[model samples]
Target: MTRSVALFATCLGDQLWPEVVEATVAVLERAGCRVTFDPAQTCCAQPAFNSGYHDEAKAVARAFVEVFERADAVVAPSGSCTAMVHRYPELFRDEPDWRARAEAVAHKAFELSAFLVRELGVVDLGARLSARVAWHDACHALRELGVHDEPRRLLRAVAGLELVELRTGESCCGFGGTFAVKFPELSTAMLDHKLSGLDDRVDVLSAVDSSCLMQMRGRLQRQGSRVRAMHLAEILASR
Candidate 1:
């Protein structure tokens, strides 16, 4: 059976890390899903929502709901964005009709790892990657979405991959969307603390969210660190 999945190309994934988008499609297709992309899709308004702009966030959230409503399932490469989508009903609390629609969209939306492991019942995609990798738990994915073990389960099943534990794997990488911008020094301080936990033995650092990777990768590059940061989708799609 072929499940129709609407690939919600997250703002960062589409603009900054398109490879993650492609990798997500490849992995979903490998799982017997027919993936579709809609240009009508845009940001899930997480930035505005996080910045305390409910009206603006609601507008973007409505657009997202309308765009992905018809798909059998909507999956995003970003756990943060997926978490934002799941909160659509709260955003539309004043409008009952929109709230109902938002609830439906929320029920259908899922992060990539969760959809693969929980919905499809697939832990392994026969991916091969010869590297010592450490998985970072994106705050929204772990705390908001409760997706701590699914990604680890999937990574453990990958052939030629050695999954190592990061001392600060469960801590925030300090990329709290606008939080970094609002508090630069505090964000940098938090990120530096997280980086210290990256063991020198790690060839690659993997996380379910590209936003976290982007933040960590920038700091790694600035400091001339050799460890590379990659999204879990890219690692899982590796063949």
Candidate 2:
């Protein structure tokens, strides 16, 4: 039986990097899953939730649950958004109605790499990309979802791809949703620490979340760093 999956082409990936959305579909199709793009999807409402606006967050969460319930599973190319769906339930636990729905959705949401390895049984896409690359372990995906190894496993499977060790492998890019805007100086200081660790030997720095990449790229460009920001789906879709 062909498993059907819903694509959460998140707000960031949808607006900033449409190619990542396309690449995600390509990767899923290559793995033999029937992918459906739910145009009705919007921000996972993480910004609202993180800002302590549960009511506003629930409005979008309700729409998401309705749209994704039909699919056998929901797959997102973004680690942060997937993590939100998976982890946001705790925030709603005080409210019984939202808590149950949040639990049901969290159980179904899967990050791209996890979905590929666990649900689709795809070890690799037989993809080839020649570039020295490093990965950023976004806070939610790494700590919350325990997704540290899955992305690396898939990256290693790509022919000619080299995964380098970032000096502070577990450091945050400092994008923390509204955190960047609220404390720009502190955020940049943290980002500077993370970027200074890069050797510039890598041609691309890839992460599961675009928000992380965007912040990193801004600082890297300011310092004239040679590395370019890329998303994992973009790397996997590489020929």
TM-score of each: 0.98, 0.95
Cand. 1 TM to true fold: 0.98
Which segments of model 1 are wrong by more than 4 Å? none
Task: Note the residue pairs that clash in candidate 2.
Answer: none
Model 1 error, position 6 (Å): 0.4
In angstroms, the error of model 2 at 109 is: 0.2
- For 1-239, candidate 2 gives per-residue lDDT tens digits of 57788899999889988998999999999888898987888888899988888889878877887777667788888788998888657877787887787788889999898889877778789889999998888888888878888889999999999998799779988889899999999999899888867776889999888889999998888878789998999999999
lDDT tens per residue, model 1, 1-239 = 88899999899889888889999999999999999999998799999998999988888888998998888899999899999999999889989999999999999999999999999999989999999998889999999899988999999999999998889768899999998989989999999999899888999999989999989999999999999999999999998
Top model number, TM-score? 1
What is the C-alpha local distance difference test score of each model? 0.92, 0.86
Candidate 1, 184: how far from true, in Å? 0.8
Clashing pairs in 1: none
Candidate 2, overall lDDT? 0.86
Off by over 4 Å in 2: none
